[model samples]
Target: MTNQQTLPLPMALNMTLGESLAKRRTGRAFRANALTDDELSTLLWACAGLTGDEGRRTVPSTLNLKAVSVWVLRDDGTWRYDPAKNQLTRSTTTDCRRASTTHQFDFVTKAPVTLAFVLDHDVANTIRESCFYVDAGTMGQSAYLAATALGLSGCIRASFDHKALGEAMALPDNLEPILMFTVGLPEGK
Candidate 1:
């Protein structure tokens, strides 16, 4: 959100809240195809992109701290989303599929995109854990609705190698990987 180069997103999709809610659902199976730039932009916007001035986020957080950091993980690379700027700054160029998903399921990596929600666990440990869960789940649900509205599919999964992912992503020492939402077109599509 600071001085880093930013990628401006396209206009967000116009959809009623009711329509997006009705379409909301979880997805596991994924097709190996790249998402259009617009689709990707909309998905990230729905997750944590800025919707207004003063660093407001789509999902509400405890004290508006917005501790959750979204990392867009793809086969080619990974990036951190800057909500205020509505942009992504590259995190790593090495392939991270193996680091993004767990042994419990392979579909996570199979999906074209995995949005990883990381946090400062030390801060979480010092506070009520439920707040963290609520905030993270709020962001995850936003992604699901966005995917559905775009006729895409996604899954919020907890089964991942946290240590490996953090190591692979070269996360800062203070941060900890918490949850992941995988998104992509269905196989039949």
Candidate 2:
């Protein structure tokens, strides 16, 4: 609903299935280089955006629940990913990426883009609680694969203060932060 900038990404990129799979890994170190807005857009689309008029999405949800929403943390601030429109709506002006993880993870805060996967438990009420993890896992893998194919390094991290992160981001009561995926270009050797 707010004014958001949508970047124009190439409709297609040259990547084979095997290449993308091989590229998949948890990248803890990242370059400070900023990810182009277009790459960010494409990454979001590949994760959960609507892919057709019938309203099917890039990733499958339980009963088409589509309960998982992504919040992107960048230098500017935290923004909600609007998959329907393929844009990011600014939510806060403060960068909370540093506060996301506990000290044990050797957390890297320099990644240009950090994606927080927030699940709307209310929407998936019909499904059992145990099943939510399955849905979240599927979405996470999709995001990882997409990032690899896009020539970006990505990692799905579960290390974070869930309650604090949810409150800091001012997320809706129904939305629970599940997984955090940090993405960016790799630093030169």
Candidate 3:
């Protein structure tokens, strides 16, 4: 995926949902290895990629609004997952991984991929504030299960600086940053 903006992921999964669930584990540390383009593509697809021709996705959404925006922060830069195209669009070229999270944990930057699950306030408010969180959790779980299947590790964190993150991505005021996920090879890998 070097010098490339879009990546196509394999449609078939190597592991079943049950297998992925049983193998799922969290990590607090990570190796410096980078996640392959296919790995990132599959993970993002499992998280929020379109699953059908009817605009359905891998995870359920609140009020069927599909209001959550998945942001990918990597060592190279940041991108926003566009489900419709099944690709990631470059959000910035600044390698804002460190600024993606509040400097609370060192692993945030060490991990190869950091996902910020943002919410569109207008669409989420249509149902309830809690709906957004519920949808976000489902997406996060999708990422975790995919990582487990891929022989990788990841963790979800609530600690992040909203203002700084917004500025880092140059995001609009309507998109509210919520939960986050940091994933990569475990420390020894």
State each model's C-alpha RMSD to the native: 2.9, 2.2, 2.1
> How much is the lDDT of residue 170 in candidate 3?
77
lDDT tens string, model 2, 21-124? 88788777778888887788777777777778877987877777777788888778888988777777887877868766776334357887788888897888
Q: Write the per-residue lDDT of candidate 1 for residues 1-189, one digit (tens) a residue.
A: 232335557556677779989878887888989888788888888888777888887888877777778888887677888777667777777667678776735687678888888887666657776787778899899998888878898889888888899989888877877888889998798
TM-score of model 1 vs. true structure = 0.89
Tens digit of lDDT per residue, candidate 3, span 71-164?
A: 8988778788888876778767777678877664588878888998999887766577887898899999998998898888999877888778
How good is model 2 by TM-score?
0.90
lDDT of 1 at 176: 72
Q: Which parts of model 1 have CA positions greater than 4 angstroms off? A: 1-5, 122-125
* Better model by lDDT: candidate 1 vs candidate 2: 1
TM-score of each model, paired residue for residue:
0.89, 0.90, 0.92
Model 3 RMSD in Å is 2.1
- Screening candidate 3 with a backbone cut-off below 3 angstroms (N, C-alpha, C), the clashing residue pairs are none
User: Weakest 10 consecutive residues, lDDT, candidate 2?
Assistant: 99-108
C-alpha lDDT of residue 53 in model 1: 87
Give the candidate number with the greatest TM-score.
3
